[model samples]
Target: MRFSRGAAMVALALMCLPGLSMAADIDGGSLSWAWGIPFAGILLSIALMPLLTPSFWHHHFGKVAAAWTLAFFLPFAAVFGPAVAGSSLVHAMLAEYIPFIILLVALYTVAGGIFIRGNLHGSPAVNVAILAIGTALASFMGTTGASMLMIRPLIRANDNRAHKAHVVVFFIFLVSNAGGSLTPLGDPPLFLGFLKGVDFFWTVRHIFPETLFLVGSLLGIFYLLDRWYYAKEGVLPVDPTPDTRGIGFDGAVNFWLLAAVVGLVLFSGFWKTPLGITIFGTEVGLPGLVRDAGLVAVTFISLRLTPASVHTDNQFSWGPMQEVAKLFAGIFLTIIPVIAMLKAGAAGPFGAIVSAVTRPDGEPDPAMYFWATGALSSFLDNAPTYLVFFNTAGGDPATLMTTLAPTLAAISAGAVFMGANSYIGNAPNMMVKAVAEERGVAMPSFFGYMAWSGAVLIPLFVIMTFIWFR
Candidate 1:
């Protein structure tokens, strides 16, 4: 019933979205800080509601998300008129939200279908190995994809351990965030840069060093932590679903389907088309439309070919993806003003932010870019946060590639790495948290998780600044 209701709400929002409005002409200069209140409210709701009242948050999170979205839209419509409101709504949905959810769903569905059949005995070495593999895989299949694929197995492997929260916590650090810094395919922020004419190899060439530093350091820290925990747990619980046989995969076909999804994503990036169709005032490109269609088909193919037993083994359900879809619907909508304000740069209300990225000498400071980009990405969606900084750094691929290279690299690294600071910072962080909680691992609250990342990640970032960005 809740799913149906959420579906209806989403459908109505999409349908009501119309194009051409005050949003197109209105500069972010006119918008005030107050416009960002709804967005802040929703994120705060996400952070506090779970800790303060889990049952209420669990039951009506969708409603709360929707209400916050309406809080922005209703007032904006009244003040700016329906056309401006509709234009922002249409633009956000067509340009950002749809593609974002499509990619997440396809990856989640395909990865979830392929489950590891048998679990290994949890040892410090074994746990570190899994984290390392997942970290590496993240650069290829995406942080979200690698996380969904590896997290369940890791959880099962460590199920008998006395201390397990730290495992999932470190997984978010290494696998779900930092490991994705090396490639556009690995993380959305870099991928957005790629679509904006940043070279395919740009991230690999520049950000790879930072990625290695962060990922390598985190892995070492995790190993030490896991080793200590293993020594403390002198005895193991009888493995309920022990490895009866050697490790093997259950749904091999879904991997091909996953490959197809990846191919479609790449195809859209490389293949541009002049042909486009207008849907509800939004311009839809043929390449993007086809790619989304192909992804939807790949999702169905994964479902059809993969056995029911496979999904059952993975304990797969649509709940987590749906929750993301509904909540992000609200987020994407409410964030329109904030994005516009940032885009306004020095002319806009957030001019201080733009000014802060530059030194008095007029050179763009890479360290400040890293910290500022990271600070915003820690709260807002990292993809757009990256674009804001990328544009602030001149938005020229050639110049940014050569002259302002460190700035771009810092932006890329900050967007990907600091996303681990909060669950809502990246979609996968929340997904991992939700899944771990579902599996009986008591994941930390949103703020609690921040405490962990604040303690562990911030110092590393500071060290990285002195080592590289400086």
Candidate 2:
């Protein structure tokens, strides 16, 4: 019943999506070598997918999914080589998106784990509230913050229970990912968009439907799954020797410190502006000491303000977040050469997508940018992926929009929204998996996560595509 209702709501929401107020048709571009090179690159990546695999490729769905994405984009990028290698495009991407992704990954690692309160059996309503509030909190503090803050409380809530992993999994799907879509402050990609001229309120308002539908439906499915596990596995009662201590100040709320870090992040996002400042006679720029300094300050405050006993009580260690940092740092670095090449040809490759679609005025399709950008985001770091598309959309001289604003919104909506298509699409997916593992929830392998998304997320996106983007 919950699924049906949520799906119905999603379908209805689609029926009323904002239609284009004015139509401007722009058409095909003449071919160039720049376009061809990148298109070939995409194809070659796809062809080499087999070589990138491990012996356990079949079992490791995540690797398989990555290979599949490489396959699709590599071929596509090859055919659109001109679009893949423009220096201007590459520069913009680096200046805009890269630092943003780096900041988010760093923040997640520093915030450590979130701790949840209350047991699972206290009240069904309370459980929902925790999930809802916790997820919302995650978008702001970084998903790791919310995850770290709530996971233990949730575990403790279900401490005497056997069917708890299911709760954590749904929590991953909802609070960790979907819930953060509304604010750039909420998710790295959206936040990048915010830095790039996307109105903060715009993403929040427009994305509400997407977030609500996906989360509500997933939660509904989770409830049913939870019931099945509950029936089969009895609750593990609270430990007789459970540690019961009074709740201390939970005083870690050093608002000014966190705000300072966020302010620095925002300034970094607009690195070209005077808003960029120097502290102690030193300039603080994107990916520079100033930004790192802010993060350092917040980390110190969060650590110092948190009760020493809380760390002991939570069994907290920096290992899991550290691992995420190390792994993603490698990923971000290795992919630089690849992303650089693709970015160089951003325009020409995207032009190829435009050529494929016929416009009503025989004008090239305005939407080619949306699809190309969206398609790329599902594979690359969504923040940079978004900037690539946003720049492309804004760069087109023929685009009818009088200002960059609408195009920015469309680009942002596509990049931030579509990024959820696969596990590797965003940083949070990796973080969630790591946190889940720490909590002892055996999450689905990469492909397994996709299977779940395929079952739930994909259809919802399809509806969104037709209703919002199409």
Candidate 3:
């Protein structure tokens, strides 16, 4: 009778539960706000140390990131036993960082292989046309893909010009940042949002007008500036690369590979398979595992298929991608507690932050969401910054898509658009900057770049605030 009663109790408990264990989740309320200091320190190191001591930071950057990781982890492990820390580490690696790096590597390798041969003269019309093309491609191939593909051609176009720096700056504006505003494929933050259940076309539907306005305004400004410089410098009597064989691409096959990348991402988003495995309390969905594996295969296929000559011509190297990987490794790790606190909402230490962006009447304020998300995204990694605010705005994709649509739009726009505010604002910004500087463009210093963004981009964002956010 006792055995029968025990079996019945077990059956009752089983009936009360879902079919499987819920995915591992962090308890933000259990965290201290002080846990964020190392994350902030890593961020500050990323922002300042490079500007302050370029060579030292460049060589020691990996070690610097490691130090910050230890700073966060040692204390974190001490406070919360190794099991909790291990779960957190496993969750960050499997669920977030690995996929993030895989996608970047696949895009970079694929895009790097595709080279546009033949020299392009950086005429105003030609430059504007390229910018327009890149902006359109960005929403599909990703800002990094579009940027890596285009930045070389762009730099080559202006190589003969006396006034070359501004061209690179505008390239950063449109190709590296604003162009990516229309879809999840265009930007990392949006992609992360998509993985979290935001629909594929949600961004294109909501943020299209804002992207058009900003991108259009930037193009117009660049054209006028380029035209004035063209007139001032006039044409050179002897063209540097005077070969008249119009533009032709070197690696045509990679375009299909790029398309496959897009398909895989969309497949993961749409295909729901009940099959998946739990790894360290994290659910590894079947589609995601397949997508990531497919991407790895695509990367190898591109590397093997494309001629080495194309890479040489493109001046392709792995340095920028390496830098992003090392730096973001530390970023993704340190920001764990910060993201946890944010997810805790009003009950957590960061409740005041959530309270700041909400109206007294309990409605979400779009303008505040825009500024708060944008401001942090400008300094922190935009992808995770987007996640933080996305949670703060109520982490429900269906609700965010419909009734709270404006809030979602604000978060998306802020994360994608304001990434140009600083070099460290987005991964591609630093890559573009490093590439431009190496190509002999006298890039603006950190604060110096801010002056340019403040002068050109800030007013436009303000106008956008009034037009869209209001």
Ranking by TM-score: 1, 3, 2
Candidate 2 lDDT over 259-288, as tens digits, reads 565677666555664545432222345445
Question: Would you list the clashing residue pairs of candidate 1?
Answer: 22-84
**Which ten contiguous residues of candidate 3 have the minimum total lDDT?**
1-10
lDDT (Cα, tens digit) per residue for candidate 3, span 1-470: 22223323432443344431334466999888899999889878876787899999978887788788779877876776555666676677778888887888898899989989788888999999999998888888899889888988988887888878788888889999999988888898998899889988889999999999999999999999999999999766766665658789988899999999999988888787889888656779999999999999999999999999999988888877877777777888888898888778788998887788899899899988988889878877799889888888879999999999999999999999999998878878888887787777888887888888899998998998998887
lDDT of each: 0.87, 0.52, 0.84
Best by TM-score: 1
Per-residue lDDT, model 3, residue 454, is 91
- lDDT for 100 in candidate 1 is 92
Which residue ranges in model 3 land beyond 4 Å of their true spot?
A: 1-25, 231-242
User: In terms of lDDT, which candidate is strongest?
Assistant: 1
Q: Which residue pairs of candidate 3 clash?
A: none
Number of clashes recorded per candidate: 1, 57, 0
Model 3 misses residue 454 by how many Å?
A: 2.0
| Candidate 2 ranges with C-alpha deviation above 4 Å | 1-106, 113-126, 237-256, 266-289, 344-375, 395-410
lDDT of 1 by residue, 169-193 (tens): 9999889998888878999998888
What shift in Å separates residue 43 of candidate 1 from its native position after superposition?
0.8
